[model samples]
Target: MGLILTEDQLILRDMAKSFFDEKSPVERMRALRDSRDAVGFSRDLWKEMGELGWIGILFPESVGGADMGYGELGVVLGECGRVLAPEPFMSTVLLGGNAILLGGNEPLQKELLPDVCSGNRILSLAFQERGRFAPYAIETKAKRDGDHYTITGRKSFVLDGHVADQIVVAARTAGSSGEREGLSLFVVEADAPGLTIHRDDLVDGRNGAHLVLENVAVDGARVLGTVDAGADVLDAVFNRATVGLCAEMVGSFEEAFERTLEYLKTREQFGVKIGTFQALRHRIANLFAEMEFTRSIVRDAQTAIDEGRNDIAEATSAAKARCSEVAPLIAGEAVQMHGGIGMTDEEEIGLFFKRLKAAELSLGDAIFHRNRFAHLRGY
Candidate 1:
């Protein structure tokens, strides 16, 4: 597998970089956070992204998507990371949209994916019900009553859940929580009766919603896959989303490192540039090596997805573990090297620090992925 981007991928990266630089800068995220925007991100900007085919990269042509691979999508996500764009690529495209695409029946795909491709509908996955990232530890229960099911439970850390047009809810239809079997996925509308959504402003300046479902009713047709086998779908979705998040983390740390390096060159200490200090230079040199190593592993995971390798689980876990390790180190070093300025919200480097920390904990932290990597290797 190739770690380097092809000519076409490079062109796509350049185009996406230019688009994000022009349309969605760090200022946009700051503005959204400061105003506590109801929608968090701009739908008009999302529609523009749809018009440019950025939202449809993972979907098939039958659903108005570009029928592309994760490599292309990773490139766009990396650019989004560079600017900290508060878009729903992770919530909609990777989590919710992929769940439907990979597991849903054709009619459901035809009904929902088209709108998703056009950015007309936002989607989110309500899977995490606890404090950590346990995929199968779902307590939400769905009871089937003839043609409809009554769902009752709560979900936390539902990314973009406040604005999602539809939510892919994970409910236990058979087995108990923490068991891989007997889990089911159902598509529930955001405005459905008996459903409550509480919007939360995350530490990273992004938005997540906590949802409380009280006897929420869903038709049997909304089920994404088999009645008691949602873990399969969840596994596939999480793998891609984890790798995509790793790609974003790579971009974020790379940007933070560059900005810190620039500051070292310009900021003066003792009437001389701080970059001249041998100790500081050594630190930055180590940071650069870690950043490049992270970039390579992330690229390898993305390539594994695109190439449909059988060992995608191993590759993604490795990538996430490495990213989880390097991102915090880079962010911390960047902030420390910048001194007082990095501690404030007014500085851009601080934003990267927050985002990197959030990303590190998003899918799974370093220790979690390391254990997962070991298990996957049959150790």
Candidate 2:
């Protein structure tokens, strides 16, 4: 399929690029990292983005959104990744906001989505347990009581969990661990009783947390979608989020490649530009080819989602797996080509390398997605 953007999409992409370039640059990320910001991002900037209608890119028109598709949102996210801008757009907007949209009832949507669009609320997903990426490998249990449920389990690597206003949690409502049946999703307040959040600083200048729920009580109204039929909702959310992540990886890869190429042209070796060397040129060529391939896959995945294709899951897994494999390759080649300076914190390339490493492991690594792809095909 052709991956060309429409006029409006092109405008949106340019607007996002300019906005990030002016508002949240690499220096902003460095400052956030050094200060160990409690929120791990700039709320002021987030609000400004909300005011600019970026936070509502995927929501429907009734909810104060621009009524755009995932492709438009992908364009914006790709630009955000180019600068390594530190914000919770992925966690808050893509993962959290999408969870509600996909699973929440009409009343819940009416209550929450406007705040989400206006940046008055932050949301996150707490799904993984024991480092497992399988959607069905949930051990978190939510025991039902009279019009309520008591959640008891631990969630690890919850994105933006430390500062989110709400978190969408996955728990086993009726099935055994690793079973696809009887899974459910619930939105719990971040500061709810019996909940403890422990924040950890990540190498990529972001923050995540481990959440422990000790008899945490949630009202029946907090349940998202049907009581014990949330597997499809969770699956839809994950697949979309994975595709979104792949879009961000595409941006990172493109920027890293661009920076490495610029370095090659300017950096001197043996009284000549390193880019002139045949060996390094071939490596650059190969990196460029891999980037193009990853870009195509990402676009295909996003387009599949926008078109509501039946094969979206397989396409998303393929895109994410391809991006996972190529991100590290591009980062490694960029670092090696840049020589000793690339290893230092003072160099910008190192930041890209760290971000790529984080992305490679975030949703599912290349190996994980490869296995998932095979499984999806009944291999």
Candidate 3:
């Protein structure tokens, strides 16, 4: 498998980079946060992105998607990270849309995916229940009636949940919490009765929601895949999302490092450019090396998902673990190198700093992925 981006992929990357630079600059995220926008993102910009065919990069052509691979999708995500784009690619595309694409029946796919591709609808995955990342530790119960299921439970950290038109929920049908079996996936409408959504403002200027499903009923037709075998789908979606998130973190830290480099060149200290200092140069060199290594591993993970390799799980874990570790190091160094300015909210580096910290903990943190990687390797 090739580790480098192909010629076409490089073109796509450059195009996306320029596009985000022009349209979704860092200030856009800051503005969205300060305004306390209810939707938490610009719907018009999202639709423009859909018109550009980015929102549908991964879906099949029959569903109005570009029918591309994760490599292409990763390029877009990396660009989004550079500008701290506040759109819902993670919630609407990676986590929620992938669940439907991977497990939903044809009718379900046709029903929602086209709208998703056009940016007319929004989707989110309501799987996370606790503070940490645990895929199989679901406790939300989905009790079956004759032709429906009554879902009753709570979900926290539901990305963009308050505005999602449809939510893919993971509910336990038989097995207890922490077990892999007896789990199920269902697509519930946002306005469904007995479902209360509480909006939450994330530290990184992103949107989140807490959901309380008290006897929220969904038709059996909304079920994705088999009744008691949703873990298979959840595992696939989480792996893909983890790799995608690593791609975003790679872009975030890369931007942070680049900005720090610019500051070193221009900012003077003791009547001399700090770039001339040996100690800081050494730190820059080390961060550059680490960032390059992170890029390669993330590319490998993206390729593994595209090629359907047997080691996809290992590759994803390695990518996530490396990103989770390196992102903090790079963000911290960027802040330190920027000195007092970085600590203030007005400085752009602080924005990257906060984003990197959040990204480092997302999907699975460094320790969590390290343990997962070890177990997958039979250690």
Candidate 4:
């Protein structure tokens, strides 16, 4: 099979890379990282990105989305990973955005998609709970009350949950009916009464939160997808999210490899560049080889997803597992190669290492993804 990216997709990726280089340089990233609100996003840059049709690149055109496929979308995310542009693109545009596109009705999409597409509002999928990463193990509950639903639950580790204007919560609407009938998704305003957000400081200084829904009330219209049939919604949203992160890790892997290689070439030891040593050179070369392999696997998953193949679920986990394990290995080595300066905050290598570590742990880490891969194999 030919493994060539379409000309348009390649162009899109280059434009995205150039866009970040021109506007979101290392200086801007550092400035935003040190700010009081390290949600680490630049609204103006987000607006520019949205205007570039990056936010809703995969959204259906009917509801103000570009209707682009995931291959194109993956390219943009890949560029973000390369540059460390600090916007919640994956959490909002990729994860939460996919939930609405797949499970939301036309009216709900019309009501919300425009704001998200325009970068005027951000949305997050509030699914995970404290110490719970599996979407099916929802501790949150929604009780039916005549014409509306009253929700009460707690969700933790929601990416950008603290700052989002809207949140899609996965809660149990019914008991396990022997027929996979326990989960439901509800859209609630972020500022709804009885809703409290507890922001947490993550390792990478990104914005995440613990949400407490104490008698949060909303209209029945907010229920997304078919009631009592949200398992598919979660499946679709999560599979896409997992796959998207794999693509980003590919970018992270490549950039961290190159950065470390740069260090090897310039950083002198024993009167010669450290890279000239056979052992260190071999290590960097192995990492380079792994990065290329990672890119191939992620692209294969992306193509599968775009083609709507069942192979995507299993292959995605495989790719994520490999990347998660390999990315941190690459990042840690990159840091080690820099010696003392790598551990110091003054160097950008430390930041890349920190983010790479964070990315490795997010969504599903190597262990988590391997389990998923095992389950998918039996199916």
**TM-score to native of every candidate shown:** 0.98, 0.97, 0.98, 0.95
How many clashes in each candidate? 0, 0, 0, 0
Estimate, for each residue in 197-239, the C-alpha lDDT of model 1 and write its tens digit.
9999899988899999999999999998889998999899899
Worst window of 10 by summed lDDT in candidate 1: 1-10
Clashing pairs for model 2 are: none
In candidate 1, list every pair of residues with a backbone clash.
Answer: none
User: Cα RMSD (Å) between model 3 and the true structure?
Assistant: 0.9
Give the true-structure RMSD of model 2: 1.2
Count: clashes, candidate 1: 0
lDDT of each: 0.92, 0.89, 0.94, 0.82
Off by over 4 Å in 4: 176-181
Error of 2 at 379 (Å): 3.4
Model 3: per-residue Cα lDDT over 1-379, one tens digit each: 4898899889999999898888889999999999999889999999998998999999998899999989999999999999999899999999999999999999999999999999999999999899888888999999999999999999998999989999999999998999999999999999999999999988898988999999999999999988889999998998999998998898899999999999999999999999999999999999999999989999999999999999999999999999999999999999999999989999999999988888888788999999999999999
As a whole number from 0 to 100, the lDDT of residue 251 in candidate 4 is 77
Q: Which residue runs does candidate 1 get wrong by more than 4 Å?
A: none
